[model samples]
Target: MFSRLANVFKGIFSLFIKDMERKNPEALLELEQENLRKQIANFNQGLAAHAGLAERLMSQVRKQETEERELHARTTAHLRAGNKSAAAQNALRLQSLARELEENRRQLAQAEETYQNLTKAREVAVNAARSKIEALKGAINDMRMKTAMAEMNEMAAGMVSTIGGSGDTLSRLHEMVEEERTKAAGRARMARDSMDMSEVNIKEAEMDALADQALAEFAAKEGIALPGAEASVAPEANRSMGSNPQSESQ
Candidate 1:
């Protein structure tokens, strides 16, 4: 039953913590410290209350001891004055009250001891709570710093990627422009250096071959078989081989 009550309270407290976290984490942190302080205060208050009770009990015990002593002296005086029965009754009442006070004092001492231990525990708990808060705050700050650095690094990477892409695109554009210029230079040479003599010689050789083929075609059409013979006779009658010295002597 006691455990069940403890669990119920724990669940309620956990819900409260979650709500605090959702509302304002920083505020929740402060609230947690406040809670620690409250706990310490409560502990100190409880210790003080028990100690106070012990003090009051001790005061009553002292008063009771004095009254008992006075009662014993009266009972002895009464017995000595020949009132034995009344003295016995008075002594019994005093002894009974003394026993009760002493028992009360014993309980008060036990409670005071428990309070002293609780005060010590409260001190330790406060120190531990404060240390935990400090560590958590440091961790939170470090995490924030690391998060900021990570974001900065990511932004830098993005900028670098953009710059690198622009560099590559510009370099490629320049290369393309140079390639077009080279192609244009080649076209200009094709236009400026039109057919020179060597090019003309090559075309004339092609034309000569074409004329021979045409003559062969015409000979075939007219059924002539002496085209090669006519061509050979014409070459032999065309010009002298060289300026001859024998021809000058003749």
Candidate 2:
């Protein structure tokens, strides 16, 4: 049971750390970059030590070459002077110097090669790490943009559903409005149909005609030419008005 509890806690901690990493990947990236820098620094320190060894070996090789040349000159001079024992001693020393010179040259070559390889390896590793880090930075930005777009899509989807519900209410309102408008139009049509205007129109026409007749007679009696009256109608109206008194007597 205790082990199970510990495992559960560990799982929770792992999940929490994963969540944190996701939320702040840049921080993790910075930490990794710093670690890379430290590693490079350490590697460079070791490389510096190797370089010092190479330099020392180069110096030894130069010194051995110089000693070999001096010993050869001394051995030749002793032989020319007829000092056989001294010449033999110089020859032996020259032989020893030759061997040492050869070995030092070989060691110098190896040290120089190792130093070059270490330097090149460090450069390649650093470049690769920087490239990967830059790529990771771009990936993180893209992830953030995609995550934002996903959230926006979810919000829009939620809004669409909410607005869809409101759309039903709006549709109902429109239907109610249309029904009321149709009812109002029907009521107006019915009221119009129920109205009787034929007799009223005839009465109004008769009154208008009478008023025109009175005006025509007054114009005829006064001998005034009325505007918009037919010339023949005015003379006929005067003759009729002049006969009205006689007709009333009869």
Candidate 3:
């Protein structure tokens, strides 16, 4: 039972971690990038150790070659001096040096090859990881943009529905505006119909007569012949002559 409970708790924790990873993919990607860097550093350290070994082996081979050359020269000199024992001993030592040199060369060659392989492996792994990280970054940006667009589209759709809904605020506002406009127009028409025009017409006629009298007086003062004044005087003279016989008969 305790084991089962532990398993359940582990499952819950795992689920929570997975949820966090899903929600924060960039964080997870950054973590993976950091791990990749650490792994590469560790691999490089190992490669450096292997490269040091190869260098040591190469140094050993060179040292043995130098010793072999010296031994060969010594053996030749001893033989020429009729010292067979020393020459033989030197030859034996040279043979052993040759074998050791050959072995060191083989190990050096293998180490160099192993180092190259590790280098290539590191390059391939790092390249693959960088490509995946870049791809994930692009995908995250695209997801964020698409998510924002989806939210905007949803909001726009909601606004459209709300604005177009029957008896909504916008509709009521339009109705109220139209009703007020119609009432205002009706009130304007009623006011126009109710206004008395007789006084206005009388005032307008008086203003016209005053203007004409002012014009006649100005024309007379300027000694300007006025055709309108002459016309008016002729009409008054005709009316006086026609009314003289009526006044005598009365």
For every model in order, what is the number of clashing pairs? 0, 0, 0
Candidate 2's residue-wise lDDT over 120-205, tens digit each? 99999999999999999999999999999999999999978876785677768888999999999999999999988998899999
Model 1 misplacement above 4 A? 1-24, 42-45, 167-250
Q: Model 2 TM-score?
A: 0.70
Q: What are the root-mean-square deviations of the candidates from the true structure over C-alphas? A: 19.7, 6.1, 5.3
Ranking of all candidate structures by their lDDT, best first = 3, 2, 1
lDDT of 3 by residue, 1-250 (tens): 9999999999999999999998898899899889988998999999999999989999988988899899999999999999999999999998988898899999989999999999999899889989988999999999989989999999999999999999699899999999999999999999999999999999999999999889988998999979877887899999999999999999
Please give, for residues 198-232, the per-residue lDDT of candidate 1 as tens digits.
Answer: 88788999999999889888887997876576788
Q: TM-score: which is higher, 2 or 3?
A: 3
Q: How far is 224's C-alpha from truth in model 1 (Å)?
A: 99
Residue 157's lDDT within candidate 2 is: 100
Q: Which stretches of candidate 3 lie over 4 Å from their true place?
A: 194-203, 210-250
Q: Is candidate 1 or candidate 2 better by lDDT?
A: 2
Sorting all predicted structures by TM-score, with the top scorer first, yields 3, 2, 1
Give the clashing residue pairs of candidate 2, or none: none
